[model samples]
Target chain A: MDLSGLFAQVLNGLQYGLLLFLISSGLTLIFGVMGVINLAHGSMFMIGAYLAYVIASLTGALWLALPLAVLGGLAMGAALEAGLFRRFYKREHLDQVLLTFALILLFEEARSAMLGNDFHAVPVPAILDFSVPVTAEFAYSAYRLAVLVVCLFVALLMFLGIERTRIGSAVRAAAEKPEMVDLLGLDARRIHLLVFAVGTALAMLAGALAAPLQSVYPNMGESFLIICFVVVVVGGVGSIAGAFWAALLIGLVDTLGKAYLPEIAGLVVYLLMAGVLLWRPSGLFAPGR
Target chain B: MTPPILEARGLQAGYGEGLVLRGVDIAVRPGEAIGLMGRNGMGKTTLIRTLLGQLPARAGQVLADGRDITREATFRRAQRGIAVVPEGRGVFASLSVMENLLLAARPDADGRTPWPLERVLTTFPRLAQRARNRGDQLSGGEQQMLAIGRALMTNPRLLILDEATEGLAPLLRDEIWRTIRTIREAGLACIVVDKTVGAVLSVVDRAEILVKGSLVWSGRPDALRADPELMHRHLGV
Candidate 1:
């Protein structure tokens, strides 16, 4: 490919990677720390996109929809945790998987019943609707670039929140030894709830941002969910840094693979994951704890 | 002497379908040191689990400061000043040493004294040296120290250490013993379980010997130590 075409693909990869990181980081955190494999995590992403679409449609303003989408995602995560996840905390992983899988079906059906099956698009704020010149004859959408920047900012904030604060320390402690966290007189259940909520909120934010770039259909997050799992698996189960780096690598591989892998005529993103797993069975950065 | 700070009466508990403790009774007076003695599979660990409410007691009552605590959640029991340095040290492997200590800090019942981070560091200098190290990084002895310090951070009225020094080197075992003595001197009641019967006997006010899933013998440390044959028969070397 030409230099400008390659540059555009790189940017696309970065944007896609950043969004995947936002969604998968939460999934990995919950999985690593709580050991709960929540199948409904993707539903949270879909709900975010739907909420953003609804809010943007009603208010005709993208900015007005973002917070609503995030809050809605948080509420949904908290409700699911309180009502179902809490009950399964002590249950086996198999049971948790079954229950959350059921939740995914329920959430998808509920979304269809409430919002209908029609595809929707969130309005890219007029400020970001313009295109920016990348090369003499090439241009990239300002909206996609803005989504990349916003996701990067969120990732930075999340990193800081996990690394620099007392709550972050508690979260790490809880993740490592929940029994110890409880013995320390801190309610581990509360920390689990907080992490789940935050993770869901991030997923929602990703969904909301992606709404402008793609159709906000009921099944929109289903595809992204599979991609997010690939991100989680490639990164490592519990390592945020792993998720970030892996997401970027996967994004690049996926974007470039779709564009360039046709020449080889057989390999795909799944092939790339298979290659990574062959080398590091636990993903590139397995959680040290 | 003050009706014992903690007491477990007629306790029976076990994992699903397989009972490990049967009608075990143990008590710890405020500022007193009690040693729990038993061979492997003799219900010492099970009794500790029952006392902490981690394993439900099939039958019995647990009391702390004269209040029935059998039905209280493990966290609730902890809030009432019962801290356990569980077997295997139970340190949060992912958290730094400082974070583990801080997680257990709670205000005293009268709200007079709190177990601050600095106090814990002072008590366990090894932990201070490795403050930033993750829980899993510490050696066995240091992990045990962290476990004790983690328990102390809650300012518990009664502290229970199950298998406190099972896998430590000789020097580290001596250090742990010194620390336990220091804690006892500070007026904190302790329930210590260890294989070193001679060492624990020298430190504790009383000792309870268990066989199978029941308390087989109970008396002053001197009484048990005087009978080496009795120790060998029940403890099996």
Candidate 2:
């Protein structure tokens, strides 16, 4: 491929990877810290996209829709956590997986009932609709660049929050030594609820941000769901930094493979995961088991 | 006699159908130090877990500061001035040493000041050198000190330490025992579990020996020291 084309593909990979990181970081936190395998997390992304679509259509502004979609995600996450997820804390992983998988169908059906099965789209905010030229024949969309910047900022915030703050310390402690955290006077249950809500909100935020780039459909989350699991597994189960690196790698490989090796493009990400797993069964940066 | 700060009345608990603490009764008054002694699997740890609400009491009551706290959550119990260093140190491996210490620092319900960061640093100068390090990075002795320091930060009325000096070198164990003496002198109520009878006996005012999930002896430390055969039978030491 040409230099400009390669550069554009690289940018695309970074953008894709960052978006995957947005969703996977939350997934890993929920899994690693709380030990809940929530297969329905992708549905939150779908719901966020749908919420963005509805809000943008109603208000005719991306700015308003974004915040509303975030609130929508937060509310959904909190409600689900208190009502359903809280009950499963002591249950086995098999039960958690089965319950969360069932939630996927429940959310999909609920969305269909409310919005029908028709595809929907969100218009790119006019400010980011334009593009800057990379070369004589190539220009990268400014909206994609904006997505990259925003997702990067979010990832940085999450990293700082987990690494530098007292709340983050408690969350980390709850993951490793929950009883100790309790003995230290912090309610592990409250921390857990917050993690679940924040995790769900993050998945939604990624979906809302991707709404303009991808069509919003009832089952649109299914494909992204599998890819996200790959990102989390490759990044290390609960490591935030690991997810960031793994997402970028997967995004670049998937994007470049599709552009340069069309026939085997679909096989590239799985091959990468397989290679990494062979080298490190616990993923690249997983904490000692 | 002073009203006990912590009292377990016929506490019964276990794991999945196998009873571990069979009607164990114990009490700790304010500013008292107790050395809980037993051989392996005699329910020394189980009693502690039950007191902290980590294990559900199959039957009986745990009264904290004259209030029945049997139904309170573990964190609530901590809020009420109860803390445990725990058997495994239970450090947050993902967090920094400073963060672990800070996270546990909170005033008790009566608004008494918790252990200041400076105090912990002074008490454990080695911890001061490794404040920025993660919990997992610390050596076993440092981790033990951190555990005790973390519990102290809570300004607890009752401090529980299980296996406080397990798997440490003799020097490290000596340091831990000396620290326990200092804490006792500081007038905090403490329940300590250790295999070394002599070391624990030095700090605690009284001793309780458990055998086959039952308290076989509860008396002054010197009283137990006077009867070596009692220690031999219950503690196998």
Tell me, by lDDT, which candidate is best: 2
lDDT of 2 by residue, B1-237 (tens): 667988999999999979998898899999999999988888999999899888999899999877899988888888888889888898888788899899998887778784788987888988899999988888999999999998988888889999999999999999998898888888999999998989888899999988878898899999988887887777776
Q: What is the TM-score of chain B alone in each candidate?
A: 0.95, 0.97
Give all candidates' CA lDDT scores. Answer: 0.84, 0.87
The DockQ-derived docking category for candidate 1 is medium
Q: At residue B129, what lDDT does model 1 achieve?
A: 99
In the order shown, the candidates' DockQ scores are 0.59, 0.78
On the 0 to 100 scale, the lDDT of residue A88 in model 1 is: 86
lDDT of 1 by residue, B65-152 (tens): 8789898778787887888998898987767888777766777677745567787888899999999998878899999999999898
Q: What is the TM-score of chain A in candidate 1?
A: 0.93
Per-residue lDDT tens digits for candidate 2, residues A192-249, read 8888888888889998899999889878887888998899889887778888899999
Question: lDDT at A201 for candidate 1?
Answer: 91
Q: Residue A160 in candidate 2 has what lDDT?
A: 94
